[model samples]
Target: MTSTKTMLTLAVATAAIVAAAPAAAQVSGIATAAPDSAILSAKAFGAANTQIATTYKAQLDQATAKQTALTTQIRTILDTNKDGQISQEEYQASQVATNPLSGRVKAAETAGQPAIDQLRAPAVKAQAYAIEQVALKYDAALQAVVRAKNVNIVLSPNAIQYAPPTVDITKDVIAELDRQTPSVPIAAPANWQPSQDTVTLLQQYRQAVYMQEMRRAQGAQAGPAPAAGTTPPATAPRAPTGR
Candidate 1:
């Protein structure tokens, strides 16, 4: 299992790649497709394919209910005076009462977080697995789209300096993915770790996307060069060098 930090890094890198291209370029390219260049919205594609909403709806609802109940109980405890609103002093007092050793208010308040996490771990793991499966499906779908369109390069919409609607194969890729993988099993093994191949591919994808985005951003920030034949503005001759 990849650590949460690694997952966050991958997500950030991917997002950066998608955001690399200048908006002006994309707008200008809307009329024509650059040879072999294609843009896609990975975020949208992932959202469209995620099955957690349907597969874990019941569990999510239960979790939400539990959270609400816990919140009410905590609030009741903090409002020691039975007042409708809890004052800062009352809250502090409750915290001190709960854990005198450590004066950490949040720690005392969220003591049940560990228990909540334990309860949801299975569902969380299952949802993550489903998303991973969808990602794999997305890769295959993207490949098929690339072959069909005879495209040599695929870029996230964020990375494109310019791209025409004609070159955006996101819809096509989504359609293909839906056709090939309409649903994914949300059940995850008790202990799941992605295969080495999957890890390598995921890492490569994150790095590629991040680098492309960074390159495009740098280019965009590099303002246009002085127009050809334009006269350079003359600076007052540097004050005659002191004798």
Candidate 2:
């Protein structure tokens, strides 16, 4: 599991590497692709995702609603201060039997989790199937990109320290994949299954999507930026920067 998680971190990063060989004073023939990114970024994957979102809206909504309600219930039980919020101290207290309402708090979580999982199963399966379909074309699309670009060597970004955007062929591979398979079935057939590796890739993709959503939400909550050249509302002063 640790190895899988490590792989997920690497796989989610876009890959690029410098060229090993150069002709005279000029350098060329280097390209890179994060196969996982290529597959996930393909138009087909995004299109299929829209379909999955539509198909599983009810289930996903139920899971989200249940989760939100569970959080409120826990806070209501544990917020003995009646501060209308659960602090770290209160939250920790709820986990142990010492708190008078710990049992009810724990029970709510225990009962809510399985129901939420059941609600989420369909969307998760559909997403996995879509990822598998796009992943199937990765090797071919990569090879095609290599041949067209006359790439000498390609490497994963995780395997190296840094690379320039010009050498990263991820977008090219994504375009190739879009051409090869414009879309795939969002529904998995009975008895259909993905490999363990594809399952891990699905997990990684979900984590990435979750993070993006969080950043977006945070940005929205931050409100619009101050107008250019105008004095902004004051916050804490920062330390001076170095050259």
Candidate 3:
């Protein structure tokens, strides 16, 4: 009787295994197709972005050149001796001198600022638009790649501590983006202005760059700071203390 019951249990187990085989195969196939923790980086896509950036930079370069010319002209007028350089004395004299040159320099700076601001406004808007367009294209391409590869998870390269090169899909995404969006329009529409958020961010970025440049220039002109623990020499030992 025991041998007959053991045979019955073996038959039931074999039937169960046969029934689960197809389901196990399906699960294995899905696992093979979908990968977890795939990484993508937007930094890999820059060809189209670089073109837009270059356009904006050209505008800034033109404005900078004009400003430099105006500054050079003012400096020439201050160098009354035709020495091609303005001494400290010359700089001080130019500030208080009765000559019309000082007045012209001051007027040029005051008038030029408005023109510079006008030029900068459109350039800033164009840059913001270009960045937005590029970002949209990148996101679309990233989504397409994710779908095509059946990726279960995505992570930015910056956020990952360690990832094998094989798991990075940045190049694949960039290729897809290049095919979808080969170029980005950098021109700003008439009277175009960035959104308040973008404007605030741009203003902050400009301020930071300005402050950094100012600090760099000041440091260059002022020499390095003294080392720590530095002290002035004693003055003849103070002639010794009184008894």
Q: How much RMSD separates candidate 3 from the native structure?
A: 22.8
**Residue-level error in angstroms, candidate 3, position 182:** 1.1
Query: Candidate 3 on 23-83: residue-level lDDT in tens?
Result: 4432221211011111112332244345544655665665566555655666666677887
Please list the C-alpha lDDT of all candidates, in the order they appear.
0.47, 0.65, 0.47
lDDT of 1 by residue, 1-243 (tens): 333234345544544544566755433322212111211233432443255545555655665556545555555545557765656566445435455422333444356444544444454455445445666556566667777777654544544455556777767766776777766666756557654433444334434554565466448754222211111111100011111
Model 3 spans with C-alpha error above 4 angstroms: 1-61, 67-115, 190-243
Best by lDDT: 2
After the best TM-score superposition of candidate 2, give how far the Cα of residue 201 lies from its true spot, in angstroms.
1.2
lDDT of 2 by residue, 124-229 (tens): 7777888788887777888888999998666665655565788788899898999998999878787777767667677667666655655674477542212111
TM-score, one value per model = 0.47, 0.72, 0.41
